[model samples]
Target: DVKVTQSSRYLVKRTGEKVFLECVQDMDHENMFWYRQDPGLGLRLIYFSYDVKMKEKGDIPEGYSVSREKKERFSLILESASTNQTSMYLCASSFPMGLALDSSTDTQYFGPGTRLTVL
Candidate 1:
């Protein structure tokens, strides 16, 4: 089965600290994404990587950046954690879009999520 692994299940931090959340996927999928999920706001994309050393800033990437040094691993870095940044961060991966098998059917398999509590 395809799998995505998140490095942390929970974290607590003081405001202004840098934070890192790691994710790895075994399937060699070409698309990886990081998103923050809030109760009423749903999932907001933060960053994504399509290939090694390449990254794209998503809609809400102001406080975050990412790295894709290897095909199987992706990392999300919070330049400076803040109380308002506290939320569940999820990592997901999928095959490149527009495949013969209907890639839209691709449901992003999520990590357990890194629950960051910025104090």
Candidate 2:
């Protein structure tokens, strides 16, 4: 079974602080993603990595960055936290798209999420 875990379930941060959100997957998936969920905006992808050390900016990546130095771990970095960046941050992992014959293999397994509040 695929399992994803976040470093924190809830977090409080002050404005302009550097925030690091850590995620680890036990499934050895090749793709990992970070997203922010908000009330009306839904899940907005912040970043994604296809392989170790390879990252791509997603829909909303202005204030966010990602690092995937190891296959099982991915990290999301908020360079300078702000109130507008507060949201439920989700970490997900999945097999590389089209790598498996079954489409289900491409489905992402998500973590419990870290709700970050920036004051």
Candidate 3:
């Protein structure tokens, strides 16, 4: 099974502090993603990297950015952590098991998310 690791399970930061969350995947998959889940609203993507040094902004990329210096590791950076940014951050990866998405049985497996609490 593919294993994804998050740098933290919980983080508490004061407002305006820069925050960094790290993620690593061992599957050597071609895709890595970062998302934040909030109450009422479902998971919203922050950014995704298909390969090292390659990144695409997801639905919500405002206050957040990502780095993929190595294929096995991806990092999410918050320029200024705020109370509004306090949410569950999840990291995910996907790989092709066979051919197409449905036929390949490729599914995104998420990490045990990091919960951020800002005051």
Candidate 4:
């Protein structure tokens, strides 16, 4: 089974601090993503990396960045943490779904998520 783990389950930091959230997957997946969930804003993708040293900006990437130095590891960095950035951050990994439209193969396994609170 593919397992994803995060560096922290809950994090608390003051404003203007730098925060790093790490994610590791047991399976060698081609795509990894980071998303933040808020009360009504829903799950907004922050960043994703399809290959080592390659990354793409998602819907909301203003205060976020991502790194994929290794196949199974991805890191999400908050340049300057702020109170408005407080949310539940999720990490997901999925195999490279080819042309086949099977949704099963396109499924992404998610980690427990890290709840970050910036004060």
Candidate 5:
């Protein structure tokens, strides 16, 4: 089973603070993603990486950055946290796209999520 782990489950920080959220997948999946979910706004992708040392900016990458120094670990960084940045941050991992071997298909496994409150 693929297991994704987040460094923190709940976080509280003041505005302008630098925040780091860590994620790790035990299955050595090639793809990892980060998203911030808010009420009614839905899940907004922040960043993702398809391979080690490579990353792609997601829809809402304005105040966020990502790092993938190893195959199993990906990190999300908030350059300058703000009140508007408060949301439930999710980390996920999955097999490389286009590699659906069977009916189970390529499914993304998500972590419990980190609820960040920026005040």
Candidate 6:
């Protein structure tokens, strides 16, 4: 079974602080993604990594960055956190896209999420 875990379930930060969100997957998936979920905007991809040390910016990546130095671990960094960046951050993992023989293999397993509050 695939399992994903986030470093925190809830966090509080002040404006302009550097924040690091960590995620880990036990399934050895080849792809990992970071998303921020807002009330009406839904899940917006912040960053995704297809392999170790390889990252691609997603829809909203201006204030965020990612690292995937190890296969099982991925980290999301908020360089200078701001109040506007407060949201529920999610971490997900899945097998490499298009390589799944069945639809189930392509499913992304998500963590419980870290709700960050920037004040």
- TM per candidate comes to 0.92, 0.96, 0.91, 0.93, 0.93, 0.95
Model 1 per-residue lDDT tens digits across residues 1-119:
77899999999999999998999998877789999999999999999998999999999999899999999899999989898999999999887766426554456777789998999
Report the number of backbone clashes for model 4. 0
Q: In candidate 6, what are the lDDT values of residues 1-119, reduced to their tens digit?
A: 67999999999999999999999999888999999999999999999999999999999999999999999999999999999999999999999868766785778999999999999
For model 5, the superposed segments whose C-alpha errors exceed 4 Å read 100-104
Query: How many Å off is the CA of 84 in candidate 4?
Result: 0.6
Model 5: worst 10 consecutive residues (lDDT sum): 97-106
The best candidate in terms of TM-score: 2
- lDDT (10s digit) by residue, model 4, range 50-109: 899999999999988888999999999998999999999999998777732455477889
**Which clashing pairs does model 3 show?**
none
Sequence-dependent TM-score of model 3:
0.91
**Candidate 1 — what's its lDDT?**
0.89
lDDT of 5 by residue, 32-110 (tens): 9999999998888889999999999999999999999999999999989999999999999988867756443468889
**By descending lDDT, how would the candidates be arranged?**
2, 6, 4, 5, 3, 1
Provide the clashing-pair count of each candidate structure. Answer: 0, 0, 0, 0, 0, 0
Q: What is the C-alpha lDDT profile of model 2 across 38-78, one tens digit per residue? A: 99988999999999999999999999989999999999999
What TM-score does candidate 6 get on C-alpha atoms?
A: 0.95
> Which runs of model 6 end up more than 4 angstroms from their true locations?
none
Q: List the lowest-lDDT window of 10 residues for candidate 4.
A: 96-105
Instruction: Point out the higher-scoring one by TM-score: 2 or 5.
Output: 2
Identify the superior model by TM-score, candidate 5 or candidate 6. Answer: 6
Off by over 4 Å in 2: 101-103
